[model samples]
Target: MKFLRKASGLLIAGLILSACGQQQAENQTPAAANGDTVGLAISTQNNPFFVTLKDGAQAEADKLGLKLVVVDANDDSGKQAAGVDDLLQQNIKVLLINPTDSEAVAASVKRANEAGVPVISIDRSVQGAEVVSHVASDNVAGGKMAAEFIVSKLPSGGEMVELEGIPGSSAARERGEGFHQVMDAQQNIKIVAKQPADFDRTKGLTVMENILQSHPNVKAVFAHNDEMALGAVKALEAAQKNDVIVVGFDATDDAQAAVKAGKMAATIAQKPAEIGQIGVDTAQKVIAGETVESSIPVELELIQQ
Candidate 1:
């Protein structure tokens, strides 16, 4: 009878221990859950520059054993907002975005902010919302370098066309500012035609063709990005105006190839991959409760044949 009583007490203790163990397991965070997922909202994948940027982010995420969810906005502000909304629904640990439109992205950023998800802006910026960090090249400096290159090629100072990026975008505004700063200093250098191509290759081609029709004597062209620059090169070739000096930003693969073949005079090489990697790293740091700087500038260089 005493042996039976002891066994009953032991059984009760064992059951309690098992219940405690199960409760502890339930309280612990899941190994493959929220902390393991990262959301990346890219402006567009059509551009090689952004494609490389996304690849860099993905590589870094893989190295860190994190799952990255990527969404392309296709350069549409509305689509970008919707994409961020979708990512928010997935309970992403962090949000890294290359905004299609700086101002329009603020709403998405605000939503992430409300959700308590840290945001790291990559390559582009958000206007109104608080961001944990921004990772990109010094675009203004790159623009200045491009302008100087064009000026150096045309020592006598001549008419040039400026193929701007998407209107209201930070890249477009800052690059235009930097280019104008140098060009304005040179009284002899004149920008005959300045128009926005929305940083698209097709629009760049059409815009360049139209500008060529109006300003055939334009001596040089400065495009805000490689895609636009390549399109401008196409138009120049078609018009047999190959002699015009062309300077472009973003040393993408195609741009480098063009430079090697002497189709493009030069390209300011912004490290898009580095920018992307740093953005992901920053997101991780923020997720780990670390404070990062508001802005992180990647290195830039000039590439020529």
Candidate 2:
């Protein structure tokens, strides 16, 4: 009887091992043996546009089987500075940064360079940094597209309002520069009201509400982002002044809905997903000690009618 019990115990152990092997085979995932790691420091994950970019980066990281760390700055430059410094402390192989303030992040960029961590600035650029690469949309071109739409929709020469984004952000500066370039060429279209909304819908709503009251005849408005554009629309609706044309940037889902409903006249779309993907791809190359270009410009699209 004792001999029979020992044989039965051995049989049970063998069965368990067999099951374990089968489970391991069935539940296999991508192996992360590349010994590569990357970190993404995004300004704010609150914005849908930035969320899309994060998703793209995550997807590419999984595909590449690289360890990826992500952190949100919540639109705070100080927080962003801390997060990047922390990532560096972890000795991450590469860094992908979507800066909060183009200028404020320059020091962090320099720090990453000092640590021998190659940085690929995604969407926004940091000044005076040894960045390995920059992946972003041509903000100037996108702004120009938005401006063209605004001019076309209000061609009879009317006054307009402008809502800008973060003060030191490349997107804000470049897009504003592009819009101003076009605005400079137009004689009849006057920018009577303008303010910085900080790319927030709530701020946009409040600022636009005040602007509308003062510039009641404002024929149109150009918001740097769909969030602000949506806010401006709500302000217009609440004040019973929905007739004014609104052109938004980023082509967010809300803005697209507004466009379809004829509430928004047009929007300039950027490929946030593509920017994230390219940023990750570049990060991987840098991790492998590979050389990459200094800038990777993304395409933009104009949406109307």
Candidate 3:
């Protein structure tokens, strides 16, 4: 009876030990390996720029054999916060966020910080949280480039309209700052009208129409993005105002086509694909416990026909 009891005890202990060992093995797997995932939260995929960014990230992830989980906020800050929460629940190793509203995304970023998930900011930045890295084009510089181009076209100074992006976005603020840095100095070139179109083509069209109603003599238009520029182009065409020099940012395919067709005068080419690719690469380094620069800037160029 004693011998049978000893054998039974040993068997139970062995089974428990074996189960623990299996669990430990599973825990030891590297996050980039196996089915572990990283999360990508984008401001919106409606824009071709963001779609290209997603495609770039997806391509790099596939190359590295890493699983990437993507979420589209559709330009909604509330939806973005909820999406971040969902990604956290899925045990994502890292989070990549392109914020719709810089200030609004702060709370979500803070939550990720507290959860010990490293965050990488893409395209736009977060106002009130710590980020492991930021990957984007230099909006300020791009804006300066656009302004310089505008100056070249309208050296004698003229009335112009500025189509703004969404309120509270870092990109908008920085680009506006750079534009004003140059335009403010030019006493001859006056911004007759400035309005926020919220980075939507439809909104851009409506806003341009309203601005034109009052500022019919506007000589040039500088849109913070290509979508707005394209919309402004349509409005100008409709109103039979063909002489206005329209300079846009983000040389998306459509914008490039417009430039080539002489519809848009110029645009700043921000390589969003490169930004997305570098973002994933940075995430991999972070996952491997490697240090990375706080800001990674992709090069920009002025694209014109």
Write candidate 3's Cα lDDT for 112-163 as tens digits.
9999999999999889899999999999999999999999999788899999
- Summarize candidate 2's per-residue lDDT along 1-305 as a digit string, tens digits: 99999999999999999999888665643234544778899999889999999999988888877878998999999999999999998868889999999989999989888888888899988877778899999999888888887877776889999999999999899999999989879989999977999889999999998997788888898999999999999998898877888998988788889998988888888878888989988887776667898989988887776
Pick the winner on TM-score between candidates 1 and 3: 3
How many Å off is the CA of 256 in candidate 2?
1.2
**Model 1, total clashes:** 0
What residue pairs clash in candidate 1, if any at all?
A: none
What lDDT is reached at residue 278 by model 2? 90
Model 1, 1-305: lDDT tens digits are 99999999999999999999888767644422344788999999999999999999988887665789999999999999999999999979999999998998999999999998889898887889898888988888988898888888898888999999998788888888888888889888899999999899888899999999989998999999999999999999999999999888989999999999999999999888888889887777776678899999999899987
Model 3 misplacement above 4 A:
1-32
Q: Candidate 1: deviation at residue 105, Å?
A: 0.6
lDDT of 1 at 22: 88
- Report residue 48 deviation for candidate 2 (angstroms): 0.6
Q: Which stretches of candidate 2 lie over 4 Å from their true place?
A: 1-32
In order, what is each prediction's RMSD in angstroms?
A: 6.6, 4.5, 7.9
Comparing candidate 1 with candidate 3, which one achieves the higher lDDT?
Answer: 3
Weakest lDDT window of 10 consecutive positions for candidate 1:
26-35
Candidate 2: global Cα-lDDT?
Answer: 0.88
